[model samples]
Target: MKKFDILALGELNVDLLLNRIAGFPEVGKEIFAQDMTLTLGSSTAIFAANAATLGARVSFVGMIGKDSFGEVVRSTLEQRHVDTSNLIEVDNAATGLTAILNYDNDRANVTYPGAMSLMGVKDIRPEIIREAKHVHVSSIFLQETLHKEIFEIVRMVKDCGATLSMDVQFDPEEKWEFDYRKILPLVDVFMPNEQELMAITRKATVEEAVDVILPYANVTVVKMGTRGSLVISGGKRFHMPAMLNKSVVDAIGAGDSFDAGFISAYVRGKDLAECQRLGNLAGAVNTTAAGGTGAFSSIEAVKEAAQRYFGQTIEL
Candidate 1:
């Protein structure tokens, strides 16, 4: 038997969130913030943690440093019941981190790639790939080495006889230079938000972007925030409306949560619509708590949020 159902091959980082700031940052001015929090962060970390919470046998393969921040990342994923056996620690680089300045609903972020950027396809071994039935990779743009060797990374998973999923989280540089025609055909699931879909495809509208990818894409899932998600498979479209939380706390990791929900179900052989429903609920639940993982402490917690808020039970 495989050691895990899902292997999260992605970036790891810590988040330093500053809330209730006195004023916006200026050229060289000092600012004070009333609230501060330090927690595990990164789209991949959120997906791995929440997937484990939803009862998936999940493992993480990412790079960290020999610093205290790295310890926090390791300990946090372990606390979430995510296997960290494949996490690589390097002596030269510090762990990645993002400083988030929060306003009411939106936030400004400054990221330090650090050690995460150093991990490339060479860091992943065939043995590790064989240990999982599915491999998930995210935040392609943030890691320079991974970005440069993405085609090889996806191909490696396929050659190892494992399915692959990718969430190309926003490209900060706005270059959107990924070779989708060559890459999408190899990916089992292509998960991207609406804006990301347009940006990556170099199209002005979602419809046009989807058209661009249709020929080469397999199963494409588009995250349309607030409106829920749209799934395309075998040229058929499935739309799931958002089950909005009555009282939303924050939306820090909702999309990642969506990925967690969908993949958790997908690996268990759930249908497209069922996967989309759970994904929507997971995303809405994520917003009911602080950060990306607050609402997903346990499977019971996730199910409770689904029932209490959306009046739906998450069987998976």
Candidate 2:
């Protein structure tokens, strides 16, 4: 058996969340935030942690700095039951960080890419890829080297005979430069939220975006918050409504939580429809808590929240 069920690749950071902000910030002005929280951040890390919590054997392969922030990132992953043996530490740059100004349902973020931007194709070893049944790559734009070398990385993962999943999170520069044709063919599962999909595909709507990539993509799951998710596979389309959480703490990391739930179920050989259901359930559970991983403390915790909040039973 492979040593790990999933290997999360690319990007690692810490999130400094400022909740209940007075208003959006302006030049030469500062606003007050009622509450603050510093927690593990980055889309990939959230996926790894929550997948592990769902009982998947998850490991992380990313870059961090030799600093306190990196310590927090490492220790937190360990505490969440994710393997960290592949984390690379660099003394030249600090660990990555994002300052989030959180409002009611959404937030604005400013990130310092830091060491995460330094990891490239050379840092990833083929043997390491072979150790996992699947590999997940996220936040390509957040890491400069990873973005430049993504094609190479995806080919390597396929060569290692591991299934690949990708979540192309928001582009900080807003210039979505990914060539979905070249990359999606190598990716077994492609996960992107609605806005991100439109941005990357330059399509007017979610349907248009899916059409542009359907020829190359294997399975594409589009995350539409509260409205639910859309799944496309084998030229078939299915839409699943969200398990609405009326009282939301925050929407931070909800997409990553969905990815975690979907992938965890995927490696266990669940059907695509079931994977989408678990993903929707996990995403709803995410809003019930403060951070991306807060609601997924354990498998039991996730199942409990799934039943209590959404009135749906989750096998994981």
Top candidate, metric lDDT? 1
Give the residue spans of candidate 2 off by over 4 A: 19-35, 102-108
lDDT of 2 by residue, 6-34 (tens): 99997999999898988888899988899
Per-candidate local distance difference test: 0.93, 0.93
Ten-residue segment with the worst summed lDDT in candidate 1? 244-253
Candidate 1 Cα misplacement greater than 4 A, ranges: none
Alpha carbon lDDT at 230, candidate 1:
94
Which lDDT tens digits does candidate 1 get at residues 1-316?
Answer: 8889999999999999999998799998998999998999999999999999999999999999999999999999999999999999999899999999988767899999899999988999999999899999999999999999999999999999999999999999999889999999999999999999999888999889999999999999999989999999998888888997767887889999999999999999898898888889889999989889999988888888788888989886
Give per-model TM-scores.
Answer: 0.97, 0.94
TM-score of 2: 0.94
